[model samples]
Target: MKKIALLVLVLFCGTSNAQKKKKSTTNPIVAVIITKTENLTAEVIKPNFYIFRNENSIKKDTLLLKAFSSSITPTDCVIKKFVTKSTPLYYVSWTEKMNSETKLKKETIVVTNVQIWNPATKMQVFSNTQTSTNIKEQVFLDKNKTASETQERNRNEGYNFTLLPTGDFTLKNKAVESKYNLNTVTMKYELPQKSADVSKSSKKKKK
Candidate 1:
């Protein structure tokens, strides 16, 4: 009876330890959704999106959308299916003004509107808009270069581009933060390498 009692106590302690370990390892789940639209363009622009949980990358996907004559409709805008655990950060980078003339030096304006929604309640919790503008100058001035050579030169030089702001949330109201525990979640955003466009082309070649 003494031996049996000792054995049972040992098993209970082991089980309690295991339960504690499991609880420590558990992480919170986060879903990342990305949507894109061009102001005035005929071609469909499929952009690449990335998600990171803490400092580690969790998911990478291409945002593919149906071709629209002028602008993307509400139904055709969003690309979601990425789900991750722990704290999540999301970002997307794409070339804008695909149809614009690169030879002409002009100012390019990019407007980004961001909205964060509560998945459980299906309500928007935060919204913000940012606009970035840059003047694009003629990079390759060699007229003797062939069309393909000019294209190659243009490809090597990163052209008109816009980077969407990283997905991070901060609750303005103390009550909301306390109720949701959103303050515990942290997000970090990093700019893509300058060779991102070249990498994009490489991916296309592989596909």
Candidate 2:
């Protein structure tokens, strides 16, 4: 009787260990939500969103046991456009406030940041903050503008980006027509900067 009991105990232990290992082997799935700044939504982001899953920025960066959600999720972002339909390219931009010394008082309106967020990596890849060269004449008015007025009027001059699968995209100052060129730009590279350590999952976005 004692010998029989020992054999059963060994087998039970082995089965338990196997089950634990299988649970750990399960892959992890993350949620990704890309926000579009109003006007660009129809042309840039919404048009080809299905392609995003194939993008290296979205695919290669994350691990998946499984993730499930709406095909795409939408969020609001504040972006001001200087020209409408002048160029076929679409872009999203965000700005930071800075106090500029003026004769009458201080002023604010310089966009110092633009970036894309990867839910899988929980990392915000930043754009070239040095977009001074690309700001087109009409994109943002610079001539004959006051300090405060110049800061507010000059939207396109501050920053711009082109979304690419590699995630290492920079824009040419010249405008070009491309479906993937729709990019997310922010005045701060860190979106939801407060949540540095949090890794987002599809469940969170659904909520």
Off by over 4 Å in 1: 1-105, 136-207
TM-score of each: 0.24, 0.24
**Model 2: per-residue Cα lDDT over 113-139, one tens digit each:** 443433334444334442232221222
- What C-alpha lDDT, on a 0 to 100 scale, does residue 75 get in candidate 2? 30
How many clashes in each structure? 0, 4
* TM-score for predicted model 2 compared with the true structure: 0.24
Per residue, candidate 1 scores C-alpha lDDT tens digits across 89-187 of: 222332233233445465555444443333333333433444455555545545764332222112222122222232333322323221112232332
lDDT of 1 at 86: 41
lDDT per model, in order? 0.37, 0.38
Residue pairs with colliding backbones in model 1 are none
Error of 2 at 132 (Å): 7.0
Worst 10 residues of 2 by lDDT: 42-51
Model 2 clash tally, residue pairs: 4
